[model samples]
Target: MNEPGYAIRAEQLTKRFGDFIAVNEITFDVKQGEIYGFLGANGAGKTTAIRMLIGLLSPSSGIATVAGFDVYKETENIKRNIGYMSQRFSLYEDLTVKENIRFYGGVYGLSSSEIRDKTDFLLKKLELEHARNMLISSLPLGWKQKLAFSIAVIHDPKIVFLDEPTGGVDPITRRQFWNLIYEASSKGVTVFVTTHYMDESEYCDRVSIMVDGRIAALDTPRGLKRIFHASSMDEVFLKLARPEKVGDI
Candidate 1:
């Protein structure tokens, strides 16, 4: 049994697609209410690893649990206990802002009364009251991203998984998004996020870097910089993932 303080736990977790091993034996733990950043270049096996952690894809070997439920055996429970947002805002473009909230609330098993209360609260919380009846497609990208994240957590999940959630947003919007993450973390919601933005990695309590399907480094951003003798997460990543670049050296 995993310790009660852990939100995510993996032991020699691995994934293999036939002869191709996508994720080698990787082991790590994320504490309850912690913000953990998962970073990697494209095709570094981050997606495959996240799928296994969130119970979307089964691992060929090893073990993983999310929110205290086995990834393979308790996927439904894991899904229920977690919120997820991808790079593309998952909102329905055709649906009104409030409609989108209600629909997702329903999907998460929120009752009619609960959904109604949440919708009102979300509109005010996200400062979208005036846009509540507006179609999602009509909202600005930043607003849409914020709304998408708010809706994902309508059920008050224990953890939220953000897969490149800040992609394409302006710097100010990205900063606002990080503020939201900080607020969520302060409220005891563990945040598991993946991003290509090296600057974003600095915001995490701890970060794990994947290189060619393996975790080459995992630590606090400052600690990683010290270990790699680099000044920023960007330099650290380049050193770990692509040391051949003369500029990086």
Candidate 2:
């Protein structure tokens, strides 16, 4: 059964590689339908923690759950309840837009009719009907990014994980991408995203900052600004995640 109110829960969740700890004991919970931002600098273990949470990597210690499925015991069920979009975008370049939608919809166990119906709806909603027959490779980066995200949640997953989804897009594209995110959130889909864009932090319902494989702060963007005594999320992130001067990793 799903957790009463939390979409994700972890108590002292940790991971280790040899003697080195990749994700030190971290505890947190994401409430249902919340936009939870996961932020960390390079080597801070945000990805490792996500890997363990999403069942790609086993945690070395502690307990965790996603969509009420135990990370240790119900990994397959967790996979079924969550959608994932990687930074590189997961569409096959050779596949037409319609083809990719059909492929992923089938992968999620939707029937032929369901896929067909959703494909039409998605194409129209994203204004991609004109491009539905075109190869994914021929689409602009923004189009591909939006298509990838739409495909990720085509099954209406309980949660969606976006890993640096807006990495190289222009400002307008990023704004458009976030509009989709807001629409999803309004529909009760939990969003767990990892991004370096400080401005994006303001959009999140709550944000967690990681430093040296440990979460140094977790709060609402406004709360974080107050706690860090800063004027913006950028200053808060810098104070907690970047203790060293520029040129330091």
Candidate 3:
């Protein structure tokens, strides 16, 4: 279940490899049930920040809390309370849909009966009932994306972190996948997503645009557009990303 207030909190989060700082001192918060988007160009430290938040990578410095547990000291607790789906699908290509779900559920400590029940519900909800027996490799790209997302949260995590969840899917399929995200948020699941697509960023309730490992902008889509004096998210991003400076636009 979600806590009463913030779902995620970060303070001066920093990550470094030798002299290369992958993520600088960045801070942000994600409210319970909110759709929070992390937007940036490739290698802008978006993935690095997410890895720290999800407990997969240790930060060189700074502090963070996910689902009320400290990221550095309470990583296991954070893992238990959150789900993650990376850009790489991460499903076993040879496994059938049902098998993949069962494996992931088991990893999350779900009982067989619970996995079965939840799998049935998810398959129906995703309209994948007919494909439940199909091998994951045989499924279409869009179906696999949706299935991966569903499996990521099958254990009923309070928060779900998606890193470029709809990367290469067609526009229509991407819209459908977003509908699923909306469904999850409506059910009180806080979604933390990262994407390069400015259009997708607009769908977020709030967005943080990262540049050179720092948050260059953070606000609602309308707020961003208003602040940047732009007509759309693309224009807003361009203005922030100009070589001159964030304020030059």
Candidate 4:
């Protein structure tokens, strides 16, 4: 079993590249089944911090763990326990929807029989049974994103990392995508998502905002708004990221 307390825990985590710190010393914890939003602007180091937490990049110092596995010593174990969906949507455009599901299932070490069962369930759930034979490249962007999210958690991973999972989609599609996130969370899957969409941050249970390679604020959306004396996450970000532009908000 993993930790009895948190799905993910980081204490004073820092990542440095040469003399430049991409992720400054930061500390936070994600409880089991929580929807955590890692919010930041383009250069705010959200990706870098997430990379460290996901075991893609090594942290310079501090302590951290994912799914109860030490980040530095048990990365392989961590990898086995988590699913990742990248910003660009982790799907093969050339492959059919069913094919993509099968491939990822295998990569996640599911048996052939398990893959077959999951493929069928996924197709039915996404209402893509009719499109299973169609190439992913032919699908609409919204459908593709929904399918991508479904496949990410096909293996019942303990945690799923979504790096801007709802980018480039219409508001309705984004809302649908969040429904999937909520479904997964209901089943005890911790969701750690990184995105810059201020509107979407409202859907998260809690969010941490990064600014200039450091965590500027971390709180529930309502709590952050209260603390920053702002109306929304965007205004909160403006107050933290660009103090001089605070007047504009």
RMSD vs true structure, all candidates: 1.3, 2.1, 2.1, 1.4
lDDT per prediction?
A: 0.92, 0.93, 0.92, 0.91
| TM-scores for candidates 1 onward, in order | 0.97, 0.96, 0.95, 0.96
lDDT tens readout by residue for model 4, 1-249: 455869999888999999999888889999999999999889888888888878899899999999999888899999999999999767999999889999999999999999999988888888999998899999999999999898889889999999988888999998989999999999999999998889999999999999888888999999999998889888898888889876664
Q: Supply the TM-score for candidate 1.
A: 0.97
Predicted structure with the largest lDDT when compared to the true one:
2
Q: Which candidate do you rate higher for TM-score, 1 or 3? A: 1
Candidate 2 lDDT over 1-249, as tens digits, reads: 655999999999999999999899999999999999999887899889989988999899999999999999999999999999987778999999999999999999999999999999999989999998999999999999999999999999999999899999999999999999999999999999999999998999999998988989999999999988899999888888656762274
Model 1 misplacement above 4 A = 246-249
Worst 10 residues of 3 by lDDT: 240-249
**Cα TM-score of candidate 3:** 0.95
lDDT of 3 by residue, 101-219 (tens): 99999999999999999999999998999988899999999999999999998988999999999999999999999999999999999999999889998899999999888999999
- Candidate 4 TM-score, C-alpha based: 0.96
lDDT of 1 by residue, 96-142 (tens): 99899989999999999999999888888888899989999999999
For candidate 1, the C-alpha RMSD (Å) to the true structure equals 1.3
Q: Residue 91 lDDT in model 1?
A: 96
Give stretches of model 3 more than 4 Å off.
Answer: 1-3, 243-249
